[model samples]
Target: MAPIAAHPVRSAARTTLHTVTVAAAPDAVYRLVADVSEWPQVFGPTVHVDVLQEAPEEGGEQLLRIWATANGQVRNWTSRRVLDPAARTVTFRQVVSAAPVASMGGAWRIAPEGDGSRVELLHDYRAVDDDPAAEALIEQAVDRNSTAELDALKKTAELGADRAALHFSFHDSVRVDGDAADVFAFLDRADLWPERLPHVARLDLREDVVDGQPVVQHMDMDTRSPDGSTHNTTSIRVSFPDRRTLVYKQLRVPAAMTGHTGRWTVEPAAGTDGAWEVTSWHTVTLDPEGVRALLGPDATLADARAKVRHALGANSSTTLRHAKEFAEARAAGAPDGAGAEGARATT
Candidate 1:
């Protein structure tokens, strides 16, 4: 999947701006992020915090009592955290049930940066009290806490890659050269075999909503080898027709084979000569046995990554080749009075 863009949840008033560069990889930094208890470990203060409440549902609400010191000022605030993993985003507020002196909330973004990674954190906070004299003190603390929090995260991600590996993800999209309607038509034909591509035995369109927005389409597919060995699994398929993108979350896979959530994005077609050509991408989690197992036990890490990319890239190329052929062929056969010249390929 592709990484998320910058997500900053800060005070609309711009009262708090804690920005810093971390010397760490995105995964390593996310470790501390996924769990807020690690705050005291990295920050000098944040001596303690207690959860006041937790909702019964996923991405539910949690009330917190945070005690910390920043820039020579000691401040305590009660806040709430709203977890939204499906969206790869989280929201925060000052209170869950009971109000407090201030509210704190933010969003996190993790992305690949060269051999390591980059993580950006943006959070907004406000002081609830009317202590006019305490505003500056609270502002300084906010700045200090936010900066230190990120620094500690960097210390962990950049230098901790060898100690413990961490992983967080952002959804990605692969582009197809054709227009949005054309892409949707091809995907609508998932029941067709690996004729358009390999490892796909079928496509099941679960629901066709007249609402005209993309919804989840549960899929059943069969992946077979030349020897007739075949594997089948159920996947959750979701697409954004307006964006010409599709995402697949693998649910069930046969033994000996592995798969997970992956976004098969179809970007707006682009070409040097202004011809529509699909640009595709494949993003997946690391295989269970790690890169070594994927590329053979003797292969190095770099080799494993390169080999995996080559393999997936090859698969993408094949699919694109087939999609191009399908679109071009469909366009070539002029239907009597059909809107061929007026055909719109704008995703």
Candidate 2:
């Protein structure tokens, strides 16, 4: 018999480079990119980020788990990053990639540009089985997300002295005399919000599931504000059921805000059985022009801050209280009438 022929393996890696000029110091811009925890607030496509393992030394590598929107869908992956503060560079490679992505790597390079800085984002990726369709999808996603991230970085960095005034975070919590799981269920099943939550006028929810378990959710909701006005918003949510936590970022924000991200957590109350603490947290970046228009020209940042805190806090407190009632009702083997209009009236 003739010798069998052998096929050579094909190399499929493709590289892309994107750059932006920012009106900030190189080190400052580098720090924004290096700090993964803030990516959810700083990047439009980022939903959440968790640091799985920290570096042993200042410039060593660290492990990170990240969830971000790709082509309007949420996906998660783990990456290893090496930080070089001296050089103002951060390099990363995906340790575990989601479907259609075989491997991925990237680097952020920040260098001096006159009085400001030039930021370069580079990516190298390969599709699973070198599939052309998957490769194109990945390319499109990278292009869209990279542009958004760079633009946001530039805008945030240029805020200069006003960044602190423009951004803020707060949380509201309630003690629920019930099981943590029941409290989490009340939050996780947001599809029932229009029925359960008085502030929710209308809601549409879609979930992406794997193996009969929901991993991500997209929500479009119309909410009634304290002023008797209705606002429509859309958001992407990532759920961690094991931790009884749900994190989300709004894609369509109100006129008075540029960005909004939030989390809902249900945990066991310390030293208390059959009791849990349910909290709602919000982080927002204000639009100065929007704030002026919405609150009148005389409104200052402080005024806008106070208005947002009060409005958001009221809604969150109402939700937490309702969730408390729902959980306690279920725990006590009482009929689940927590979503009744009478129950909402009490809130």
In candidate 2, stretches whose alpha carbon ends up further than 4 angstroms from where it belongs are: 337-347
Per-prediction TM-score: 0.44, 0.94
* lDDT (C-alpha, whole model) for all candidates: 0.52, 0.88
Q: Highest lDDT among the candidates is held by which one?
A: 2
User: Please, what are the lDDT tens digits per residue for candidate 1 over residues 173-204?
Assistant: 34443344554556544544355567566555
Query: What is the lDDT, from 0 to 100, of the residue 132 in candidate 2?
Result: 90
What is the lDDT for 319 in model 1? 65
